[model samples]
Target: MTSDTLAPAKPAVDLEGITKRFPGVVANHDIRITVAAGTVHAIVGENGAGKSTLMKILYGMQKPDEGTIKVNGEEVSFRTPSDAIDVGIGMVHQHFMLADNFTVLENIVLGAEPKKGANLDTGAARARITELGESHGLRVDPDRLVEELGVGDRQRVEILKVLYRGARILILDEPTAVLVPQEVDELFDNLRELKADGLTVIFISHKLDEVLNIADEITVIRRGTTVTSVPRSAVTDARQLAEMMVGSELPTPETRESTVTDRVMLDVKGLTLSGGDGGRPLLSDVTFPVHAGEVVGIAGVEGNGQSELIEAIMGMRALNGGAIHLGEEDITSWATLKRREAGIGYIPEDRHRQGLLLQASLWENRVLGHQTRPPASKGIWINRKASRADTERIVKEYDVRTPSVETLALALSGGNQQKLIVGREMSGEPVFLIAAHPTRGVDVGAQAAIWDHLRNARAAGLAVLLISADLDELIGLSDTLYVILRGRLVARLDPSDVTPDRLGGYMTGAITEET
Candidate 1:
């Protein structure tokens, strides 16, 4: 089946004059979009740009305050996701909704489980899931528990789940955010195959390059309004798309003089951590030094002991073997708080899981890393006014879009949340900063701003250990890049000497030869 065959004869989904409002916010105003059948329609915008809100309305996750939705020219309304699914629409959220302990087949057919003789029909569901995977070239292990699967495989399971439910229009939100380069390539291939098989895909992404590469038409959203929709051929380049997204020409970071000080701010020597099986260490003899005024980037596929390495460094997990030193002091045995107090600023990879309390107000989240900072506290009494003032400063400086510092962190857009987190981490002025995927899910404007901030921090003589799945980001920002494969530092490259393709080859363990 070709995409041509799969797409409806006309527009598969259409929205006109959509409007949604929240307390003190107009989430979406006079939005209009038309997604044709069998074409990859991309929605690009900064965080809190109302793209997600519009998608939610389409998927029936939320009812629009005013608008009309049409499926194949027929007006429709969806009060719940089930209603959308019933009309052949399925949405894959940024966060996977699979139960870790459940088998892939179980997760796929969860709410609509087949029944045989008053019991759940596991056999039929497994057979159906296998058929769907084979038909779509998805290649998933239906019996494998989600917890045992890699992130890429887990994403595949999510896609298969939607396909199994007979969805004709597939919506993917930031599908490549967590994927490595190879995985991203594979996903694009799979998406192309799906399109060829006649499925309409509405792809939401912050990465303009990917959108231009895959989309037939592109829709750019700014703030809470629809800026314009244009053919893929019209935009010409990422710069044009970026201009539309931010309504401004962004400045490129200039190559700076090597201001790296000879003194080592952070040193890791022969660091090793036992794997889950407790045999060979997951991190084997990893050693590196972070010097002041330099950004050292670790580029690796996910689960190559990067998480373990960060955990060990932060003192959240014990090290099986190795030593970590901050300046001249050994901190391998110190508590996480003590390490932080000793001048370590850590922005964890999983922001929702480890970084912020979603339900807490912005001020509370802002003061998290610096509860002991002067003015935030005195002896045992917490100073609310001082914390609010500090948060307001960050909000104003970082351009965080919030009505007040008392707004729940969860209510902010992904980009704004990231800005707040970055601001909080940088505010401490730590000697060493550990930033993992700091720009993930953020728009181009915010990404440029973040790069500028990191450069300024480096200029101020802060040593940075940056970890990211974004190969371009790793190459663009890092002075030196290290690639890890299966818990080993496989190759190190000067950023100027290596391309993203070469870096990806090293990251995927396809290239073992040292550069």
Candidate 2:
């Protein structure tokens, strides 16, 4: 055997004493981690715990103030992401960076297209992508537009993009945040195949169960430092990992006995929304009633008009034909601000896009949805004192880890941003709330806290429409569950008895209404 084949496996990456400092945030301090080659190393931490910062340092997006980075047993310093890529490191961000107008093959080969005498080598690129997809179990059409693909396909294309760039090590940030149960399983399968092919994978997520499932080693970062790194065999369950990250008991997402009442708080009747440019209807006769103190859950694969439904209810979308009733008053003709004024609260799906202005201060974002109401505004004037005070209250009550209320929303972690959104939407004591993926990117602790808040609100006679991709959360927190497929309600399931698999079957159209 050759000397290279005979030697022991080298550590794919070694980060020692990684310290990165922002103005008010010590993002990472004395962080250390090691990933064995050809193994899946999972990193877990609370929001604002500095996990993302450490990953950025490793991926060369941010330079560490004081640290040593070693790749493949050789010391290296990366001044830019291209430098990291040159040494076989690639990163896939939580938010996709693909162009919607481009095809999959075009996106994969955008920056590093193979050359043929000053011309792009399209055939070679397609062949290589096809080969990679076949080997990695990430099959997708090369000619399909990114906008025309599903969430899972987009994720697969992202993985392929990394592999096509000759990267042997992959860094995935919150890869499964938007995937349904089945899609997560498929992604895990692809990851395992990649591991089998001797590629190193760095997986960062707040989902401990998934970490335990796929990780060969688990590293926990707490409060800007590495708390512990252990083999998968060392930890038994998610509770152990959760406690290590939060220094407290892991909170469960189960709700109490039915707080549901007979009074209908918000009622939708024959809601229909036409697609832009005379396409098919986005929402077709979607009707449901959320009673006071009841939590009505909506479950569906993404891009199936859930956003349209929420927008219609929030008055952001103009409905073709429908009547929305809030406690016996037809509000379909009301404007968006009027809906907000009438006690209808909304927590949108994309926090960065629809929830908060990232460039604004936390207290400023607190004044967003309630800009016209108390503690935020007073007769054409912004009430800064009351707004700042209430923002601080939310920071304390919701356990948002930040230095001060004046900090910009962009500086906070995704989970912290999500926490702020939940706190803002739950404020103003709205009689009805629309919570879409309330705990999407939060850690177990934060997720539990949000669930507790929602449960408390439900008990206080606030009607809620809960939407989520986490099946356990959807099934556990919802008293009544409705599945929307292709803009229509396909199944009304009993959450008490349905399993994730069965619900996923309904979501993917594998199970018909008759079945």
Clash count for each candidate, listed in order shown: 3, 0
TM-score to true structure, per model: 0.94, 0.97
Error of 2 at 195 (Å): 0.5
| Model 2 lowest lDDT segment of ten | 506-515
Using lDDT, give the best candidate's number.
Answer: 2
Write candidate 2's Cα lDDT for 1-515 as tens digits.
88977978779999989999998989999989999999999999988899888888888888999989999999999889999999999999988999999999999999999999999999999999999999989899999999889889999999999999989999999998878889999999999999999999999988889999999999999989999999999998988888899987777778859999999999999999988788878898888899999999999988888999999999888899989999988999999888888999888899999989999999999999899999899889999999999999999999988899999999999899999888988887799999999998788889889999999999999999998888888899998999988888888888898998899999989987731
Total clashes for model 1: 3
- Estimate the lDDT of model 1: 0.87
Write one digit per residue (lDDT tens) for candidate 1, span 93-175.
Answer: 88889999898888999888889999998899888988888877788888888877877888999999888888999999999
